[model samples]
Target: MAVGVPELKIERVRQNYLANLVAAIACFLLEAGWYSAFMDTWINGIGRNRQWLENTGINPAIQYGTALVMASIMATAISCVTQLTGKQTALRGIKVGALLWAGFELTTLATEYIFEVRPISLFLVNAGYWFFGMTLMGAIVGGWKKKV
Candidate 1:
């Protein structure tokens, strides 16, 4: 019985891992596609008027889009973990999403420092982007149990 129990646990873990992988990949792809489409109108419209944005060669849409895609992937992965563990809740989803966003932000900041690139005011922009992005993903995944 002990051996069987261990095997069962391993199988469950494997299944959840696969599920999280699939969810993350799917979420990333979908969000990326959405961002690509959104960038066209966004860049030429609202972003064109900002002098700093123009001089910096930074595309707000692209940056925000990438952040959104990453946030979605992370939120989906967390949702999968929580679901598998039978502790799925909106608060847990939010916490996971926030952690994911923070992780990405730290990595980006570190990379920028290493490359000797000027900080592009990414902290504010990314914070807002990830907050909304992850919140939306969490709400969707935690609020809805439908398979992705």
Candidate 2:
């Protein structure tokens, strides 16, 4: 019984880790597609040309890339939390998702600020994206159940 219990615990942890990873990948790809299709084109047309990437100022590529990475991390964290809590509750999921979003938002803002760049407006825009994306991801993950 003791040996079986340890094995079962390890298995559960591994399962949760895998689920989180899958969730991260799915969220990352989805966000990346949206960004590439719309935001990238718009930025390139309005803000700078492709060759401007070689300049030293805040490159839009770095900003978008950072946001994508942050979204993946948030998705993974939400998935792991939902799995560990074992409560497929929407409220719980949203709470976890929101917290993760806030963390990333604040971190990104701080990084931009430290670099002497204007970040409040960008943070606001990214916050909206995070809110919707994470809410959707949380709802789906929280509603998923594993059968014994």
Q: Pick the candidate with the highest lDDT.
A: 2
| lDDT scores of the candidates, listed in order | 0.54, 0.61
Tens digits of per-residue lDDT for model 1, 11-47: 2422233334444554555555654655544454333
Name the lDDT value of residue 83 in candidate 2.
59
**TM-score leader:** 2
For every candidate in turn, the CA RMSD to the true structure comes to 8.2, 7.4
Candidate 2: tens digits of C-alpha lDDT, residues 1-148: 6765664453242234444455555666666665555565545434565566546589777876786667566666687776566566666767667766677655765587557654454444455656667766676566554455
Candidate 1, lDDT over the whole model: 0.54
- Cα-based TM-score, every candidate: 0.46, 0.54
lDDT of 2 at 47: 56
